[model samples]
Target: MQFHHHGYVSGDPRVRPAAGVGINRPAELPDEVDVLIIGTGPAGMLTAAQLSQFPNVTTRIVERRAGRLAIGQADGIQARSVETFQAFGFAERIIAEAYAITEMAFWKPDAADPSRIIRTARTQDDPAGISEFPHLIVNQARVLDYFAEYMANSPTRMSPDYGFEFRSLSVSDEGEYPVTVTLLQTSGPNEGQERVVHAKYVVGADGARSKVRESIGCTLAGDQANHAWGVMDALAVTDFPDIRTKCAIQSGTGGSILLIPREGGHLFRMYVDLGEVDPNDKGAVRNTTIEEIIGKANEILHPYTLDVRNIAWHSVYEVGHRLTDRFDDVLPDERGTRTPRVFIAGDACHTHSAKAGQGMNVSMQDGFNLAWKLGHVLEGRSPESLLSTYSAERQVVAKNLIDFDKEWSTLMAKKPEEFENPSELEDFYVSTAEFPAGFMTQYAPSMLVAAADHQELATGFTVGKRFKSAPVVRVGDTNPVHLGHHATADGRWRIYVFADTALPGATSSTEEFAEWLASSPQSPLAATPSGADPDAWFDVKVVYQQGHPSIDFGAVPGVFKPQVGPFKLADYEKVYATDPAADIFELRGLDRGGVLVVVRPDQYVANVLPLTATAELGAFFAPLLPERKAAAVLSAATEP
Candidate 1:
């Protein structure tokens, strides 16, 4: 459908125009906007979707392409990215359209016995407790489609601003409300016209060779290796009985290929590395044709033969692994007072090999992390200082990704001639199995503060101290739901009330605790309280010093129950095991709290506040609340 101007200001009379021929028109510019996101790829769309959630924020996305183009790019979606999609309400839909890989078989060609094949089994079923959804295989186009649909239907719908390419950008030094933006609409009849849009902030979600990064003079500092790889998605006729069963197949000739089964019938993907081909020539590999890709696939499979069939899609890419030393390169002269106003994210910030399919996921996450901070800052809920932490948190993730990719590329590039026999390759496999999942390291526990002494507190499971983010812990009985998921849906702020003593007829004091939460300002804490049994909710045991159930209220020396009175701090420590002082202070919701526990939407502790006086709680949480009212107003806003 073509978009026609319903009305125009200045000069427009009833000069009934004809339908067939097009009319020359000037570029239409938006008068005002909150945020201007460049590029409608995964990063751009996600940032738009997130920022659109805020009522005060208005978002506009500019894509060079007119519609969704299915150029086969990235294929696999990591577990963490899937969890992120769940938050956006599109994870299940993606899973339905994608293929589920249950097992991954790694085979190394034997050196001494060249014909022999060494196989080591590593499958998703083995790690049952690690993640709810292990791994999914889906095309990048499908992912883009899902995001496009969500954004179109969202309350903050992206208008007909597509096909508008970014030509230039100018950021302001002042931290005032409006940051001026100059955009050049390079499309249609009025291609040369420049449209200036004044915005509060600008995000450079553009790809690797970002024009925004160039305009701002941001340099990507790291090792840039020239690696050429060919990735194709097509239908193939193969005689190998178990070809579809394998996840990754590495041949002895230093050539690695990945076979992923797609959802629509038997569509599969074949990734092959071209030897000595010019990295810059995109057509060199694509011209090899489907027969060549299938031939390479068959060579990797070796003993098994395959037949060439119809080709659906194909592409060759010159990949690189690199990262910027700084998110924004601000010298000492430009430091303190004037930070770099222009910021780069996604591929612009970091670049890596496509060996493990981490580029897309990391890029999408960069948008997710940065969008919220920018939104909050624009809304004046947080100081500009919060923006500094974005680079701190994301840079570490990018570095870790590069290191993991380097190791994985090394493993994939291992020559079979180096190993003595099939058993030697098996030894290497066993040695590497001890290492945790690559994602675990990327999302593992670390000390919140730079120098924290306690083990639990440093590791991020402490009860009293505040954390930068909350982890996904299995807390329920039958379902074993993620704590972050439940807590995020309930509200940003939560009050975990626990009584030192239990009232009469209360079993574990958890019931009394629930009652207190129900009556307190943070009432209606549980998302599905009715689904869980009342008794099971408070499953913790309330016992005496000798470990026996204490029924008498006065018999218990220092124990306190939720429905009962407060007990000695020493008795409270035995049951919870966390810092008693922190728990008591936090549970009471008292003022001048040492730490203000700020949890992110992902449920990870963002920061911990240690307010010595109880009066600072109001001041700490005032900006974070969505309502934008005083902390005291929370009492009137909470559900009865």
Candidate 2:
């Protein structure tokens, strides 16, 4: 059987003597899917896994490669990515499989400078009060495997249709779920088949060379540095005590080198400047041949003599820094609307130097940010305009990463003479915390406009909200329960009752609010009798003064309101202070019956409505509550 469509052929063609190859195409095609994600990397896979939890939507992932491999790529997980892993339900197992790097030591290569040997540790003792998760070092493939396992266990079993590569896409301006994709299955037993996939939305997570991005005609706009770096993964047989510690060794003769410890005993990654090696040579570094790379490594670590043996895997590649000019196209005059019904994220959206190990984390978070919005819109719970926020929110994140990568690349390439000022080194450390933490916050809903005000917020209560999406916190305990451990299947809006104590007013407020929410026609909140019930729609918890659970609060400064603060009337003063404006009540038209804080699905405060404003509740939820009737009407009107 042969199938053919648009110059591509699949299957065996048995035509006379020396016949041409034939192609096969499926007769039926899916009319439209909730989401069509391109690429099977961490970004695409995780998005598919998150969306698979929603039964009402269909999620598909496509990959160019046919199978998973054990090669090590990214070897470290920042504290934030670990927290994300917790949400995806694989933090513990990942922690067990990865090596924990507690300390990082930097050394100077000159034997003449003994002081450089004891370079101050960036994080001497394991950082305290930084995050719930510690810094972990694991292979990138292992992390991908974990996600693959989770998706397989899920009811949806989100396996990518491998060998199927995206060829091109067509978009509609009429806005009737505007994107259609043409895909070709290029390999495997049933290779050369063509299929058309129609989707309400498309996510371009197809890595640096994304075909989806190409179809959209979006160019990544940023600088690409000329430097090439050699990355080697090997086991060190050296007697150096600090070999066990992650370190950066800078030698005058050779070049700058970075050493990282991996999961297995003594396995380490050595990054060297390719300028130090002969450009024409291409060789693999393994346990037996690792000694060849060690000579250059020794030159980089001049004062400390090192031995190399037992190498696992290694590769060399050029590094670059490039960020897309726009996250997605914004059509003129359509202030809140995005074009093509298509979005690009992850490496597809931005590519930068890999010094800080941010590519994986940022890419994963990008998927996280896009997945929820796509799921909700496909399920008919949110407006198509909701998709616009992905670009609005993540574009900033992409820019920040590019900027940090530039600075970090400079810092890594700095000479010992430039490091005389301790303040300069301190600034680099501060920058590290800032970039990763900021990227992590993009996944948080509290940073969005809808999460700004809690009362009028529609989607804030679901798994999408930052507070609700974040790990669980015991009322009095400092340690938090991983949010991933909780059952987050319900798609209802969440109402968190922040109260002083179990007073009559507090109890009455909680009960009345629950009752009102249960009865309100516009309310998406569901009533549950027991607070501890796993299947409860509305999550209610009282935060008392003595031992209240402290929220992560994310990167934005003023999401939390302080109990005591002076009123600042000036614009500049308001911007400088961490406190919300004292007259915010007037701004949001709220009155104290314990203000109803409405946070959006993305977790940014949407509005602050008074608990007593029952009459205005309908208008508040107008945007979030699905207008099935309106959708039906629109569908009917738009139908051919």
Candidate-wise lDDT, in order: 0.52, 0.56
Superposing all C-alpha atoms, what RMSD in Å does each candidate have to the true structure?
12.0, 13.6
Best by lDDT: 2
Best by TM-score: 2
In model 2, how many backbone clashes occur? 35
lDDT of 2 by residue, 143-190 (tens): 888877766555454556677789898887765556778888777766
Listed in order, each prediction's TM-score against the native is 0.71, 0.73
